[model samples]
Target: METIQRTHVTDAPPLPSPWRDAHVAVVVPTYNEAGNIAELTRRIYDLEMPGIRLIVVDDDSPDGTGALADDLAGQVNESHPGRMVVLHREAKEGIGRAYVAGMKEALARGADFVVQMDGDLSHRPEYIPRMLGTIMAAQAGLVIGSRYVPGGSLSAQWGRHRRLLSRFAGIYVNAILKLPIRDVTGGFKMWRREVLEHIGLNTVRSDGYSFQVEMNHLCEHMGQSIVEIPIHFEERRADSSKISLAVQVESMLTPFALRFGRRRRG
Candidate 1:
């Protein structure tokens, strides 16, 4: 397996007692992220945020990411029992399916707040404390780490085409869905447990990256309060991206489906 090297973010000051006491479960869906998972897990635990649990859902990556995650979970659990949980699926399914499974597992495990982030380290662990604080302070059901918001930025490594594509995606989704969120396609987000329960994971239909857009639409459709905070979105720390042509096609079609297809329930 390829190992990823990353600069660790210095530990932030301890969180307030109330935020530290809440059960926060971070659900990360992985495919071929063996190069980055170990580093990612370390950074999350380094936060030293009490009551924080990481649930890694692996899609049986051929590169042995699932096994690496299992080993890491075992080692972490030896000291911090249940701090890390790994769910190994039998086949390589879509990211949406992996997230649904992980989110359900988190809810079953009694997480008060659930976080969805990438395992590739593009979604920094350092921003998590602020996200938790934002949800509490804003009284929002979902808080998104947005790149298009003021003070938000993308990695300089991103080429003009990629940057434009990413920006256009948000605009296209908003144009069709009329959602108020500035970053509709952003993957880094924190969702309150009650919101996930209300939005019924089983009712979610998108099987690809469009999952982000679909979930946002459902939250807004249900009249849930949503908030976006600025985040400097980084490129993946290692390994190639998994965004395939098929996934892109699915993304383009999902908005139309949500707008014109069957009505979704809250």
Candidate 2:
């Protein structure tokens, strides 16, 4: 394990630069990612994204992901001067909760833009540049590194059934809540701090991975611009996916609730 520095950031930094100062922190919420965390963090830290930073949120992964995250942070602090933070939790909560925790940690540490993705590398790090590019060019509140967009494509490992389910979820959300982007469910999203601050993150309802859909819905409800960029989606090679049959059922049922529920849009 790498030796992660434990110093806390006490003040928020100024946010005025291209794509929110590229001071962006890619938040990887992990469960049992010990096998993948080190290499993944090393690759991203070496990618030369200028102000790009990373924060690994581990829900006290039993397989030692939390310890690995601390190690990664320490190595980053020693070798690189940019920034890396790790937030560890005591139990394995859902991804949605993990993300909320990460967002708060990032904001507390002065992150201007917070990017979210899977730690097993299913969402390619190479697309980080393109996503950030779109955000800067359009000043969009949310930029999705999408696989359903014009130039995006998915890997062949996913079966037709999986594809159909994903597409159906997109259509359902788009038609019901009427979000503006094609890949409303894509997790490889970048968000400007202003968007989170404005959306009232504390009030988000979705607790599963479907939280991605709810976030897009919130963005649309608030009339924030969303941009989609196509990219190849890679399959994970290490740990098994945390997605479950329960999540699939939730994804199918969430749009309907958001559409007709007594609450306002999002």
Q: Which numbered prediction scores highest in TM-score against the true structure?
A: 1
TM-score of 1: 0.94
**In candidate 2, what are the lDDT values of residues 140-210, reduced to their tens digit?**
99999889878899889988998998898788778887777888888999899999988776777776888
What would the per-residue lDDT of candidate 1 be over residues 1-266, giving only the tens digit for each residue?
Answer: 32324454674556798787789999999988988898888888777577999999999899899999988888888878998999999987799999999999999999999999999999998889989988988889999999999999999999999999988998899899999999899999999999999889998998899999999999999899999999999989778889899999999999999999985453
- Candidate 1: lDDT of 167? 84
| Candidate 2 clash pair list | 2-71, 3-74, 4-74
TM-scores of the candidates are 0.94, 0.87
TM-score (C-alpha, index-matched) for candidate 2: 0.87
Q: Lowest summed lDDT over 10 consecutive residues: which window, candidate 1?
A: 1-10
Residue ranges of candidate 1 with Cα displaced over 4 Å: 1-13, 263-266
Cα displacement (Å) at residue 145, model 2: 0.6
